[model samples]
Target: MITVKAPGKLYIAGEYAVVETGYPSIIVALDQFVTVEISRSKSYGSIVSKQYRDDSVLWRRQGDQMILDNRDNTFNYIISAIRLTEQYAQSLGRPMELYDLKVNSDLDSPNGKKYGLGSSAAVTVATVKALCQFYQLPLTKSQLFKLAAIAHLDVQGNGSLGDIAASVYGGWIAYRSFDRNWLIAARNQQTLTQLVNQPWPHLKITQLTPPKNLQLIIGWTGSPASTSHLVDKVAIQKSRQHQVYAQFLQDSKNCLEGLIRGFKDGSLDAIKAGIKKNREILQGLADFTHVPIETPTLKKMCDIAVEHTAAAKSSGAGGGDCGIVIIDKHTNVDSMIERWKQNGITRLSLRVHPVIDLNKE
Candidate 1:
């Protein structure tokens, strides 16, 4: 059996802007993950996914579309990734055998699918890795990234690809779309390589996690925004050279700089300030950044978060997924969570960890 575990990701900055003129985005791989275990089956013509919620096994066919049995409709993304990988293998004259693939995940947010923690991307990465391993394919990280991006775009239609990049590379990564139409830029490649290749004298990764007392809360806005729709809208707005859009980009850039500095220096105050400024910038681009489904709920969450914390902004493709709030270490997180609960918002507590090399273990 070949087992692969892939990390979920959270975008700290540069959401919509990353789609067009590539901007730097910082994403961290979370401990939560999707695990895929693949083993050969005695049967010649079937693909069985035992961990599926409803339809546990699918009959494989040469030209048939993949089937997913999950009632939640999220399982389709997994099926799409598998089909794409299989197709890619065939194109290279290295077709893989159909197998009984049992997929399971511990990455679902307690609040469910609305938390926007890159569940789809995690599944894609995990499945891709497992398939490659099963085939004994020697693929570079960049190659894996390209395959994952194709799977994601096929499933989600429009995605930033940053989440998959972080999952494959496994660390805090500064990623951008490059001129080659590839999802990741090569400029920041060396920085990521250096961090992974060298060991810090005092940093023990197993002992490290996001600080316990730091106030970071993720609140759901009760709406799921279509990433593709929002990206298309933003693209149109940028083409017109809207002033608000320009300011939004500039603000995001400035905010990213501040956050990078905060990350380097371990300054909580600076991080808080950067998040606050970044939220404002996102709010300014609301008209173009979000479709109708995103505006109302996102605004309400932003308003509520601003009232209680130092900074709050929508994470991921925005519109309405989750909003992250930065508060002082001493803030009453429990009380704040209760308040959000009363307002029908679910709260997710996350511990951010530095990326590690999966190949090392």
Candidate 2:
């Protein structure tokens, strides 16, 4: 049996703007992970997930076709990963055998409330890695990211896939979004074959480690945001208000660039300024789009963080999820935690996940 664990991701910078091609976003892999186990099956393929329930889904393969029971839809990403990988292998004249899979994750509460930590992308990356290891496919990180991304996009037509890139590369990364329109069009024309061959989609992912003096703190707002819904709303508004949206994107780009430079130079003040500017731009977008991208609770969390001399902003789609705060090492952790608690924000324990070799699985 081959087991693979992939870490979840937290968006450090870049959100809605990353949806467009050529725009860069920053994300860091979280310590929380989704694990997948794969082993050869004698009769039929099956999936048992400990994170969701006690039920299992059984399936069988028939000449490149995967037939699932479809009774349990809890692990659709895993199922999709297997199916997409199978098609990819066939396109390359390399077929793989069926396997029994088990999946679980740490990105959820005991009662099943998601932490908005990119659990779906983590599972997709783990699934692809496990299957690739089991089949002895000599695929690099870039190749694995592509396959995992295809499966993720197959499930949800939205998202920048920055989360997936973080899971694969780990650490701090500056990622440019791939051309989703091109991938969709290719999928429509040649299905998975086109994606399998053209693994690189002009997407850039570069690792960037923050200075030792800076620290990252994550606080969960207890309210899950629907990224898909927000993305759709933003798309519609952008289409209607082209000039405003374009200006927002330009300002966001400059803000992120300043952030990158600040981190490289260990300039905490510049980083703080960048974070504040980015948050304002997002608020402007929220106003123009008529969407609550920044919830009152999230805004309050940022305000509190900034009061403590930290740079604060909402991560990911920003309706109501985790917010990020960057402060110096000398900052009082206890006081900040207490302050967040008093305001109904739950401080989550998270750090940048270290890079690992997926092939070891």
Candidate 3:
């Protein structure tokens, strides 16, 4: 049996802008995660998933067959990941045999699939890890990323590929889209090969915990939005001279750079400032990303947060998911949460996990 735990991610800066021009985005791997276990099974070549709620099990067989007994389509992501892996294995002339895989998630966030917390990306990462183990395939992070991208495309048809990249690399990454032919030449050229093969100095990853007295609150908006839909909408409005969008991207980039510096120096004030600036940039692009910023319930919660907090902004694909608020260290977090409860907004309390040390132990 082989088991791997993949952490969910939150994009702190550069969410919508990253989709088009491939700017640098900062994402933190959260403590909340999904655990996948795969065992060699000679009896049945099937996949089974036990979600966060209910006793009913979702099962599917190998070779493009599905057995969905429930109404929820949450299991589709996992199935897509599995099928994509199988296709890649075949293309490599090392087709995998039938095996039974079981997946379980411990995600406590509302609506299981919202919040841009990387629930799908986590499953893709974990599935790829398990397949690599099962096939005895020695795959690098880049290879895993490519395979996961294929899986994401299978599910969504069009995707940003940022989530999978973050999940595979697990740290701050600057990604730019390159032509397929250009990538091929770069991979094969001797100069690029030498540069890639060179060893680099190791940088330590600090596990920075949120301040004990400070409060980070995430409130859910009832509406469910499709990320692909939002991406398509933004693509239609893409013009080179879109100054607002361009300025938003630049601001996000600056904010991300500030965040990196703040994180390194352990400056909480700088971090808070960066978060606030990033949220402002996101708010500026609301029309391009979606409208209304936060839901009605979420707006009320945000009003209460603004009265006593530092900043608040929608965390994910917008339209409707969850909003994150950074509060002052001296603020009453419990009372704020209680107020959110009274207003029908679900509050999710989360902490940051070290990006580099995730796979160490």
Candidate 4:
């Protein structure tokens, strides 16, 4: 059996603005992961997941195509990964193989509640990694990220694929998204393997060293939000309010640049200040778009963190999912978490997952 794992991610800074080409964002991979285990099957193949036991796929390969027995489509992300990865494999003259793919995830609560930790991105990356290992393809880290980004974009259709990069690269990273228009044009003109092997214009990923005294705290608001839906709402506002949207992009880029610098220089204060600045910028965006980027609950969460001398902000699209708190490792957080409990906020114990080279490991 060939097994692969992809860690979930949370955006530290630069949310909506990172969708534009060359815009930067800071994201960290968490310890939670989606794991895929692929085993050979002679007769037929099935795709099963613990999260969606009732929603699975039974399929067979027909000339490099995966034909599902039931087309309910509960596994669009996984199916996209399979099709795209197999297409790349075929480009390398690799024969198709039938395998039973089993997936397990800890990206959600036991009750099946989402924590907004990029579950889809994790699953997609894990699926792609598993297939690459199964087919024994020697792909570089950038190539792996590009292939996963392409598959993820096939389903998501929009937004920066920073989460996919976090999953592929792991640890903390400063990410600049590639131009989607260029990728779309190239996809039609080049083979799958050729598309991944080329330099992705404006796409950049730099892994950073974490500050020695830095500490991150996550708070769950118990209300899950749709990232793609929120992204789409912002896209609508972008069309109607061109000047405001453009300003937002520039402000976000400036804020994330400082955040990235903090990592390079090992400055915790700079990082915290950058988080606060990013929070203020996101509020401006919410005001301009009239979208609830920071909901009432998120406001309370951030306010409480400020009281504790820590910088806080809503993570990701943040209608209501999780809020991130950045502080020194020696800072007292018990009182803050107690305050959070008073407001029905739950503190999550999550740590950054380190980057490991799959080939080396």
Top lDDT model: 4
Q: Could you tell me every candidate's TM-score relative to the true structure?
A: 0.76, 0.95, 0.75, 0.98
Q: RMSD in angstroms, all models?
A: 6.9, 1.8, 5.8, 1.0
- Worst 10 contiguous positions by lDDT, candidate 1: 200-209
Q: For residue 128, what is the lDDT in candidate 3?
A: 80
93-201 per-residue lDDT for model 1 (tens digits): 6755657777776666444454567777888888888887777766666666767766777666565678888777775666665333332333245332332233322
Name the runs in model 1 displaced over 4 angstroms. Answer: 45-52, 56-76, 83-95, 107-113, 180-215, 241-244, 288-309
Per residue, candidate 3 scores C-alpha lDDT tens digits across 1-361 of: 8887777766655577666444555555666777788887653555666763343344544453434445565566777777666655655566556577778775534445555677788888889878877777656665666666656656776655666665666644434332333333543563422322332122112233444444566676555666777767766655634776677778877777676676567566776787777767776777555654456665676677776655666665666767777766676677777887887777766665455433351
C-alpha lDDT of residue 158 in model 4: 92
lDDT string, candidate 4, 70-111, tens digits = 988678999999999998898898999999999999999889
Count of backbone clashes, every candidate in sequence = 1, 0, 0, 0
User: Model 3 misses residue 118 by how many Å?
Assistant: 2.0
Candidate 3 segments whose C-alpha is farther than 4 A from its true place:
52-76, 87-95, 108-115, 139-142, 169-215, 239-241, 288-290, 328-331, 356-361
Q: Best-fitting candidate, measured by TM-score?
A: 4
Q: Tens digits of per-residue lDDT for model 2 on 189-306?
A: 8756556656456688888868778888999999998888989999999999999999989988888888888877878777778888888888899999999988988988999988
Q: How high a TM-score does candidate 3 get?
A: 0.75
**CA lDDT of every candidate:** 0.64, 0.85, 0.63, 0.92
